[model samples]
Target: MEITAKVPETSLKIKQKAIVIGGSIAGLLIARVLTDYFDQVTIVERDRFPDEPQPRSGVPQSHQLHVLLTQGYRTLNQLFPGLEEELASWDVYTLNWTADLKWLLPGGWSPHFPSELKTQSCSRNLLEFLIRKRLAAYSNLEFKETTIVTGLLLNPNRTAVEGVKLRHSNGTETQLTAQFIVDASGRNSQTPQWLKSLGYEPPQETIVNAFLGYSTRWYEYAGNEPLDYKALYLMPRAPHQSRGGVLYRVEGNRWIIGLIGVGKDYPPTDEVGFLEFARSLRNSEVYEAIKNAQPISPIYGYRRTENRLRHYEGLSRFPNNFVVVGDAVCVFNPVYGQGMTVAGLAALLLDQCFKQHTKSNSNPDLKNLGKQFQKKLALANKVPWLMATGEDLRWFTTEGEQPSVMTRFLQWYIEQVIFLASDQAEVYQAFMEVIHMTKPSTVFFRPSILLSVMRRMLSRHHKS
Candidate 1:
């Protein structure tokens, strides 16, 4: 396998090095940019990597459908020039943005569907293979598979990060040194433990988990036709039960669909049982598709997902030469398909911070690095968080945070907006744009949009 490597065109040499303690998307991305900043960049992973584009058992969400949001795509293109070209080289599908998608939201169908937002579809394994292959080309970067870091090595002051003490599959222990260390280990990250061992303050965290369960499966495409499909979302009303289903177009000429619900609402893994789950979504298209599409794998289920946030930025005493991004920072509901995109954005943020630091040869002060990155990357997650959890929380009543009247108004308005979008193409596109994060969620507040909403409200009132 010929992995393509890119070298920055510069004479400035890297006198220092960095170590990334995870080989997932976040870690890979960090290693990718570090090649330009460090003399040596090493990525440590506990799982052994496959030689091809196959899912590793280590990544829980490997086989599922991973989406590339518009903003994330743009950031990736900026960071890795010719990214789309690379994916396309391997036959990855860059389907029509919003114009071509048949996006359905709980409110109804999206408005201005095509004009509003567009998405990229592909299996996670394939994309990961291609990137790893390309990134391996970096002369300064190296990967250590089947190696796990037992803990961190701290200096005498223990105020700064230095390196990691790791144990490999062979049961041999080694100390890997680096000037900078990043804990991209994600939701299960042990950085907290390492910090405590060093007598440093632990990062503050906020967990908002309500125990939502879900199941997913993928099917191979059997034909070439327009996907004028409905995304059946069995959602909760202002004060109703929360249950939903989502179907997405993916690479390999296939479709990936998931059925999700809170409490007693999750879909079953049995073939016929899963079909019934689709049927319960109050849509014919999803069930129809399941009956027609060829199954590529057995039904897969995931319930370990919980909304977790480690606010390293909020800590008054963070390691000077360290930073954390991706799931290690803030992870949202995967049903929103924002994880990968958020990781891409976090990678972009890392690039900006490093580029400035290396360019000016500064001390790499990180007092606000974690906070700034968290705040910046979080801007992408706010809408999706509210869209997914806010709805789910409504299921058990007295379960979620009390929503304000404005929240209820927005929820009602969004439903109408969705219903209109499905019927009116212009509305559909605009709704999609906001949901896909292509446009700000506040776009609905624009003067023209408000007029349209009032018209929709009046029409609904008249019909009632």
Candidate 2:
């Protein structure tokens, strides 16, 4: 499937131009969506994008493992048709969640069976490269590489954003005006400071840090041993278990192994300590699988795994014709693998908002669209925020806001669900769906699942 340049109907094209900050996955997807509503869309990236599929300086974590959840995969395919085929052509591994993943839960190993949750495994570099390549086909889309956004260009009243101030790599400064602007600049976004500089109050922020750290190393496939699963995950149980690991087969028949530690027990980057950390996981599968594999890259350590949400929607005053998306608005702990999927969902929501805005008004401008989109994006971000922070708060050493009574109750209930998932395929499938964002977390509260949880609790109670 090929995505052709979208020629928006004259009546629907409400904006003459739009600007997107950053050129990561979120920015790229947002720019793609903007092409439908704006005559021209430009992406300003701080780093000079590489010519091929390789790690760049801008995305420090690009070398780590990236899982494109089912919803993310579907959304990407919707945005850029034939994305899956293109990934397959690059030898990316495609596997069903349940059938191809060997997951070690807190209780035991989860049951493996065929299910609908199918997705691809690859390094972040490759995925971004393919998406950017697809995006290049649009004639109206433009990329300003090695350019940084200095600040927002606002109207005299400071109630609306007119464009952005740019600083090119050549030390030249210029301003690019647009009808609409979006900030998708990831976690290090300077939107808060920019707002402050404009004499506007920044959004309130909530931080939930588990102090989790991980080290990743790339490896070449060397073993001829047959395995039932293509990927392996050893999840850390809260309070006591602070170590975990994951081994995934990515493109080019290579494996990306990540060793995780919580509560400030940072994974070591040294050769000996990396393997030792893997050996400390709850299960030996990840360690056993990679102990003999030929390592191809040095161990890379990353520690910034906090879940942060800047409540932009709650702000009393926000500039019109401007909005925040992706990590700039809400960033999740990467351990949950929700970042990319949530960004994809945000882009889709932006598309829907544009359609609705154009359909309702005969001559629409981006007057109140930013506020509307921010509120809706906040609501959309709630579930994943809870999912990531809920898990992070389970650790006793976690900082920031403490869990509420409802959160504690849900955590306890979810632990039971995790136990049941080890043996019950139905429960596991539903759990996978919720985790993959295909269904709401409310699915766990449905009558059927609730009854199962009660029965399991009662059985365990009687046994105790």
Candidate 3:
């Protein structure tokens, strides 16, 4: 591990070393920010990372596809500029959400609107590989692979983390001392239970489940195969079956198809059934596109689609010097693809904390960092949660989150706005801006947006 100094803004010695558990994207980003305050940062992982761009044992969710949103890509590019170039070198596709690609929001199929917003995508393996390579060059950022974190080592007061106990691959045990510890271990993180053993209660949990499933296959686009895949979407109507699909170009000239469902409906993993599922969508373009293409892999399926959120920050006794990111804090419906974006927002919040502490006269609030970080982290979910969870509620016949009266009104209004926007440029752009995450949902409530909605409602074209 090689640690290099990029800048020296203050001579104030960093009294704290930091430890980050989890080698996933969330963990890596936390390590990136901790460099500003820690003399050294170590990442612990249970899976032995690959030497080349490949998959790991622990990150099974990576078997599916992942794309970095505008917010995530922007945050990462700012921290490690030139990353996109590096990813492109590995065949990652940089997609303009509106220009280079086609998208189907619940509102309607996305029109060819001029777009400044862009998202870069590739296989999860390639994305993580590039990030790992960048961080590996730093001597201060250490990687202890195939090691399991047994539990945290709390001080006598049991209020702050002093270090962590680890079990190596050979079954050897060791204590890793650190001034700050971040639990980026993801959805399966054990920090909550570990905290409970030390006399802390686990945080409250919120779940909005929509039993969704997807079957994916890697197809090499032969001649005439669409590289600029029109992003396809099919949202099921309420009191009826709700299903949707997404087909987009990923790295290595491969395309990924993610078909989602409400309740028990799902895309089949069998070869023939996969095709049937694609054809079952509202549009047949995706199904037709893959008809004669070569399939290099078997049809893959994953069904772990439940929205789980641990309100760790809401806990009355959140331990000092700890913060959780990624799936550990909140796991969203994969079909929505907000997990990576939300994780990026969490890392940016970490960056903000680092900047504030670096500029502060006193040491930043390490003990209260969890709480402060939670506040910022929660903001990341506010819009996405509303979007995905609220949408899920619409599919609820037997189970799902129950929407309030305001939610009911908003849903009806959103449907009209989206359908109307399908033809009205101003209405379409406003809805697009919010859906792509370029702007906040509050943008929908603006007086200008309201006028656009009203005018569209009054227009005859919209009625048609």
| TM-scores for the candidates | 0.88, 0.97, 0.92
Error of 2 at 21 (Å): 0.4
Question: Considering summed lDDT, which 10 consecutive residues are worst modelled in model 3?
Answer: 1-10
State the displacement of the C-alpha of residue 35, model 3, in Å, after optimal TM-score superposition.
Answer: 1.4
After superposing candidate 3 on the true structure, give the runs of residues whose Cα lies further than 4 Å from its correct spot. Answer: 1-13, 225-230, 235-241, 362-365, 455-464
lDDT of prediction 3: 0.75
Model 2 is weakest, by summed lDDT over 10 consecutive residues, at 3-12
> In model 3, which residue pairs have backbone atoms overlapping below 3 Å?
1-139, 2-138, 2-139, 2-140, 3-139, 3-140, 102-231, 236-242
CA RMSD (A), model 1: 3.2
Model with the higher lDDT, candidate 1 or 2: 2
- What lDDT does candidate 1 reach at residue 121? 62
> How many clashes (backbone N, Cα, C below 3 Å) per candidate?
19, 0, 8
Ranking by TM-score: 2, 3, 1
Q: Residues 1-464, candidate 1, lDDT per residue (tens digit)?
A: 34466666472255678899999887887777778777788999999888987888779888765767777667666666666777776655655665555555555654433343444566788767767777777888889999998888876777677889999898999998888788888888888888887888787775555556677888887665555542333443344445566676666676778777665556788888888878776556677777778888888888766666676766767766677877887777676667767787678777776666556554455445545655565565567666656554555532445557877777666766666665666666666667666777777676776778788778879999
For model 2, residues 1-464, the per-residue Cα lDDT tens digits are 46565555663466489999999999999998998888888999999999988998888988787878889988998998778888888887888998999999887888988988998888888889989988888878899999999999889989999999999998999999999999999999999999999988999999999999989999998759998888889999988999999888989999999888999999899999888888888888888988888999999999988999999999999999999999999988899999999999999999988888888676786688999999999999988898888889889999989889988898888878888888888889889999999988888888888998999989989999
Off by over 4 Å in 2: 1-12, 360-362
